[model samples]
Target: MKSKFLAMLLAVSAISFSSCTKEDEEPPPPVEEPKVYQLPGLYIGTYTVTQLPNLAPLRYVLAIEPDGTITTEGLGSDGKTYYQQGTWTLTGTTVKATYKTINRTSNEVTQSATLTFNEKEGTLTEGTWKDLVNSDGYIDGKFGKFTRVKDNP
Candidate 1:
């Protein structure tokens, strides 16, 4: 009788220990997804021209829209505030702006530049601007670092 009682107690203890496991507990809560940011508004800031021989500084006010439209106004070395209307597209961290303008000589010109953005640091990676329509010359190896000043609604 004593041996039977001991065996029964051991079997019950084994069953109880085997049933209670880590898997029986509830799982952890689900993690939330990260938010995505949109870049479309007025970005007012200053840009420093980082090229050899001529290191100029310029202030710019750029308006961008989700529909790939852009308007930029800035003062050039010619002592005139130039206004340009163009279209822009953002691919990853790179932004490409294409503009069409008529010079004082009544010649229509088209230009395009690609600007890369550093989302982590909120800085612009300067890229080159080339004339697509007019093969006059190319502005090679230029850098323009810009920071946001105001965001339009």
Candidate 2:
């Protein structure tokens, strides 16, 4: 009778342990990684009018939005803040921007620029700034180079 009672106790303990394991334990939850923010299509940076000595290098924020909108902005120490906005298209390493620029005095000028992106130098090379409607060039065909500016990643 004692041996029979011991065997019954052992079976009961085994059943209890197995049921406790299945009911008490659960799977681990999934881990989520952090998301990173990124800039738009165009390379934004600072541009210097190499031909003009009196003007200082200004910050230029150029971006082509998802809806095919183009934006070109720059600030000068000479009090000539400019913003050029319109449509942009990219082909290979080259970008063509046909936009209108407005200065601090609200003088509007129409222009077009064909610029090639130089990845090695992190700059925009072979930039040709021209006035489409007027012979008197506002940028004066003076666009030469636009070096990339580094910012927080």
Candidate 3:
């Protein structure tokens, strides 16, 4: 009876030790970090002209690259198709886009606008695109809202 009790105690001690050893083992490998999206893709969204009287709503699809290249596609006056290629840059809260008119009889224009982004809300608020050249040219002064779309075509 003494030998049997000793064997049972040893078995119980072994089981408890093994359980503690397994618990002390390292956890599974840490999860891999997610990849960050590069800022060199097309962002398509609508832009509302908020200024009074000229409250014209426009739909625009713009492609921006990190190398300061920009391409915009949208409708223009006379109800015809319009496409323009330009250069763009982001400095702090400002975005400047300079585009040369593809069609003849149009002026080359440079527009500078302020931008405010809310990461929590995933929203972008854009100020009016002001003409850099003409002092009295059409200054939009309009505020537009845009939402980021994943896999924007």
For every model shown, what is its TM-score relative to the native structure? 0.58, 0.51, 0.64
Model 2, span 1-153: residue lDDT tens: 999999999999999888888558786787876543222355555555545767765666676565667778866546666887888676777868898865534445787878886545656667766667543444544454665554221
Q: Distance (Å) between predicted and true CA of 32, model 3?
A: 8.7
Candidate 2 off by > 4 Å:
1-42, 102-106, 118-123, 133-138, 141-153
Clash counts for all predictions? 0, 0, 0
**Model 3 lDDT-worst window of ten:** 134-143
The residue-by-residue lDDT of candidate 1 on 61-94, one tens digit each, is 6677778887777654566676667899888889
Q: Predict model 2's lDDT versus the native.
A: 0.65
22-45, model 3: which lDDT tens digit per residue?
A: 669899999987554444456555
Candidates sorted by TM-score, descending order? 3, 1, 2
